[model samples]
Target: MTATRAIVVMGVSGSGKTSVADGLAAALGTAFIEGDSLHPAGNVEKMSRGVPLTDEDRWPWLDTIGQALAGSLDAGKSVVVSCSALKKIYRDRLRQSAGGALTFVFLKGSRDLLTARMAARHGHFMPASLLDSQLATLEDPSGEAGVVTVGIDAAVETIVARALDGLKTVG
Candidate 1:
């Protein structure tokens, strides 16, 4: 069985990445980082203005998340990260920078669910209007390396439990 050094919870906005990653980290008795917080001020500003981030805009943020993942592995602590890693390129870059030390748990759901979730949110820089762009940009993680795809809309406990189950399978 291969040991997992890090787990990345990925999905578009409002797919519950944060909640699931937090729960998974707690369950694994390790640290969890919110990938969004690592985003540069410029990226936040762009998203706040309803502008979708280009590949160039996201490189630094992705690298930052990857570094965090690598650091956790170096510390010998399991880690979980909440990130909207919507593209294969993004995931590949993250894995590369993580030094081949990460697993991905992708939360997938209907656009309607994500849109509703985005709309109900408050005090967020990402506007609901940007959801279409986000969805469009999203490339499902199917056939990607070291990835587990989990259905969205399940209870948080159920979601976390399934993630743990997946880890056992992978390990």
Candidate 2:
């Protein structure tokens, strides 16, 4: 139906959001936006120091992410956002700002998988130790009306296919 105007690749830290988002963008012939780039310097430092950011620390960043989503959708271009929208309220903000032209693909996996991924990750502000906190904060978006949940262990093709299928379903 070509109804998915934008795709938000969401999950906790080290959940493969960037890789998946980039791959999805390439598949859809759309741009990929790294949500990390929108984070303020202070936020980066806080996360890098193994400090989990509170909702107050996140609102501005989330607002910027929302703006990016809105911008891409407003231009009628499919863009994939790599973001850790771990909470329902955060997702709600993005949806509100992005209006109706947005959809979310929640990349989910086990704690062990996420922890291992985080441990192996290099040059990222988020630390492996923070994985626990992130997981604890994650509210599964499974039953959300406009959300898609893809397993992390699946092959990239399978994951993409699931996301595409989710788009069709939502459409």
Cα-based lDDT for every prediction: 0.87, 0.86
Residue 38 C-alpha lDDT in model 2: 92
Q: Which whole-number lDDT from 0 to 100 does residue 162 have in model 2?
A: 80
lDDT accuracy of residue 86 in candidate 2: 91
Error of model 2, residue 110, in angstroms = 0.5
Worst 10 residues of 1 by lDDT: 1-10
**Model 2 misplacement above 4 A:** 1-4
Output the lDDT of residue 76, model 2: 72
Ten contiguous residues minimizing lDDT sum, candidate 2: 1-10
